[model samples]
Target: MATPPITFVPSPSYEAALRRAAELWGIQLEFWDIFGHHHVASPETLSSVLRSLGVSSESAQSLNAAIESRLWSEWSSPVAQTLVVSLSAGAIPIQLKDSEAGAEIRFEWESGGHTAVSVESADSIHPDTARLRDHQLIRIQVPLPKEATLGYHRVTVSTAGGRRAEGRLILCPDQAWQPDFLRRGGRGAGVAISLYGLRSHRNWGCGDFTDLEHFTQWASETTGVAFVALNPLHAIPNRQPYNTSPYLPNCSFYRNGIYLDVERLDEFTQSEWANRLLRSAKVQNCLAELRAAPNVEYAKVWRLKLVFLKLAFREWLRRNPQGTGRREVFLRYIEGEGNLLHRFAVYQALDEAVHKRDRNLWIWPDWPTTLHDPDSPQVREFESTHATLILFFKYVQWRIDGQVSAAQDFAQGLGMPIGLYHDLALATDRCGSDLWAHPQAYVQGCRVGSPPDDFSPKGQDWAFPPPNSIWHRDSGYELFVQSIRKNS
Candidate 1:
C-alpha cells in the first residue's frame, strides 16, 4: 500500500494569521541557503515549529487565541522574563500597567541579601505604549543601587492592588576582563594542545595537571606564548572508540579524574598506603606501559588514577578529622557548589556502583526502574548508603580546581597573562550524567545540528539534544551560567 501525500488547505485569512503567529514567535519564514538560494518555510514547517514552541497553532482560531494570550502575558507582566544589566547602568527596565504604577520593586541577590526600590511614574508615555484591551502598558527604568555587585539576582514587583510578578536579573560587567597588553593593542598568540596527547616521562600514560603546569612554564620561557589553550577537560566515560571524546562529556560540570597527578596531591603525600601503591611493582609496570603507549589508553589511565585517588581520599579521611583544616576547606568548596555538585557526585557514585554489580548495565536507563530518576526514593537511599563514594568524586573535582587555579597563578607570576585557556564543550553526552541529572533541561525527539555548509553539504547532526530555552529562562539560566562558571 502506498501512502498519499497530506495536504493543508487553510483559508486565506487563516494562512495570514498563521504566518503572523510564526513571526511573533520568532520563527523564520524565509532564509538564504548555503548555495545562495532564498528559501521560504512551508506552512507545515511553520506549524510544526510553532507546536514545538508550545504554541496553540492547530487552526486559525487557536493560533489567534495563542497570539492574543502571548501578547497579554507579555504586556501585563510586571517585568521582563530576564534582564541583563551592567553594573554601571543607571536603572533596570520594567513594564507595568497604569493601574499598577505604584508597585514596589524588590531586588534580591542570590546571597540572601536584598534592596528595595520604589516605582514612580514620570508621567511620560513610554514608546511601547501599544494599548492592550482597556489597559495601557508603561515602561519605567527603576533606579539600581550603587552597591549592586556582579552576579545573578531576582526582581519582584508587587502592587497595592494585589498584583505581583517576578523576574530574573543578571548584573554583569560592561566587558570581560583582559590583560593590559591586549587592551593596549598588542598582538599575542599561543599554542593549543590536546592535553591527553602530551607525552612525558612523569605523566602516567596521559597528560595531567602537573604536565600542563610544566608546559605552561616552559612555553612562557621558551616559546614566548601568551597562554596555553587546552581541550575541554570535561569528564567522560573514559572508554575507547565511543566515550573518550572530550567534546561529548559524561559530566560538563566536573573534570575527568584521569587528569589528576597522583604524585602531587596533598593527600597522596600524606598517605602511606598511597605511597606504597604508587611504588609497587604492579602499579609501576602498569604506569610504564601506559606512559609508553602510542595512544592515550583512556580506560587504563582512568583505572590507575582511580585506584590511587581512592587510596589518597581514604588516607585523608583517616588523618583529617571533622572540622579540621583541609577537611573544612573541602567542605566549604562543596557548600559553594551546592546541589549541582551533590547531583554530579551522586551520578558518578551510582555509575560506579551499578557497573560493579552488573557489567552489562553501562548507562543509567539500564539500571533498575526506581534508580532511574535522580530525585527518586531509591536514589536518596543510595546517597545515604554511599556517602563516602560520592564525596570521593567531589574530592577529585576539588583537587583539579586547586591545581588549575595554581597553574593560572603560576603563569601570571611568570608574566604569562593567561595561564590556562579552557575550552568548554557545548554538547553533553545523552547517556551521560548531565542528562540523567536534569532531563527536563533538554528537548526530546530532535537533535541539535547545523545547516548545510561547504564542509558538510548534507548538514551535520551532532546527536545531542538542544537545550530547553523555556526551562532555562524560567529557572533564570542557573544551569547555563553554572556551566561557564565551573569551567572558569
Candidate 2:
C-alpha cells in the first residue's frame, strides 16, 4: 500500500512564528514519523498544540501576541505558579517586569525561617534585565541556604503597586528515599503481577486482596523476594465492559472495590450474607464464566464482584452500624484523607447515578453541564439528595483500604523487604473522576503517550490529558505525593 502523504506544511514566515511559539510553550514539533521519516509539525499542528497548552497561537499576529502574553505570564507576571528548587539543581532565578523592579520578594520557610529578597537599589542580588513587550524583564538570582529544609514553602512577591502574588516554593531532594535494605542491595528477587491474575477457587471471577496476601507470603517464603510490583490498581465504576483498563482508571487514589476479598470480610463471620451472596444464581453464573475463560471477563467480573461487595457492605452495616472498631478505623481514614477522599467518593456516586440514567453517559463530560463543576450548587444538591449513595461509595473504599492494609501487613509479617510497589500512570483520562474534579489542572487537547513507533505505526495516543505543568507545580506536587503515598 502506498503511504498517505502528510498535509499542512508551513510557510517560511509561519514556520518561524511556529518555532518561536513552540519554544515558548514547550511543545515538541519535530518528532520522527513512523516510516523513519523526519518531519516537523505543520503550522496548524503547532497552533493546535500551542492552543492546548494555553497559548493562543493560531495566526502569525496571534502567535506573536501569544508569545508576548507568555513572556508576561512566565517572567513578567507578578509571579509563576511555582518555583521548583532542588538541592541538586543548586540556585534558582526569580523574574519580574521593569515596573516591579523594586518588588519585595520573600521566602517564608517552614522552620520559622525567612529570606528577604528585596533591598534598596536591587543591588544585593545581581539583577539581569532584558527588554520585552516594551518593558525591561528582570531576572533575580536567589541561592538556597544550606540549612533550608525539604518541604513545601511559600514565596510572595509584593510589587510597587501594592499588589501581591503568592506561589508555592517546592524544595525537592536529589533522590527519593530508599530503605537501608534496598540501598545495601544484594541479589534480591522480585515479581510483578496483574492483581486479577491471582485467581483462586473462591474469587468472584478475578483475584482479590486475599490472593495477594497468599501470593506475597508464598513468594517471600519460597523465594527471597524484595517487592511485588503491580500495575495501576485504580478505581472504576461498577458498570460493566467499559471499566476495562487499570491504566484508564476513574480515580487513582482509590482502589477498585472489585478487588475486595468477600470471603475474608468480617461480615462473613457475622452472618450468612457472604454465603448467600456467593450462592446467588446470577453471581455464580458470572463467576463460572469468568473462571472458565482463559482471559478475564472484565464486565462479568466487575458486575459479580460489585454485587458481592454491595451485599457484604449492607450485611456489615447491619451488624455494626456504629460504635464498632471498623467504623472508628474508617472514620480515622476519612479524617486523614480529608477532602481528597470525600471528593473522590462524591465523584463516583455522581458518575454512577448519571450512568444509571443513561449508560452512554459514563463520563463527566456527557453529564448535565451543571454537574461538571464539583462545587456547583447543583452538584451540592445532588450530593445532599443522594447522600446515602455517596456514603456507600465511601464504605466500599474503606473496605478496600482495610484489605489492602492487611495485604501489606501480611507481607511485612512474612519478612518481605518491600511489601508492595505500585506503578503510577503518567496521566489521567479527561473523562475520568480526577479530571472532572479538577478541570483546569489538565490540558484539554493534549495526550500523554508515546510518539509514532514501528510496531503499530500510527503513534499511540493514550487519550489521557496531561496535567497542566504549571498547575501541577503550583499544587506543590501534592497530587504526585498523594498518588505515591496511596499506592504505597
Model number with the top TM-score: 1
Q: How would you encode candidate 2's per-residue C-alpha lDDT over 395-459 as one tens digit per residue?
A: 88887888888888888788877788777766666778888877777888877767667775677
Tell me the whole-model lDDT of each prediction, alpha carbons only. 0.83, 0.74
| Native-referenced Cα lDDT, model 2 | 0.74
Candidate 1 lDDT at 211 equals 88
**Clash statistics: count for each candidate:** 0, 0
lDDT value for candidate 1?
0.83
Model 1 clash count equals 0
lDDT of 1 at 329: 91
Looking at model 1, report the run of 10 residues with the lowest lDDT sum.
Answer: 1-10
Model 1 CA RMSD to the hidden true structure, in angstroms: 6.3
What TM-score would each prediction reach against the true structure?
0.89, 0.85
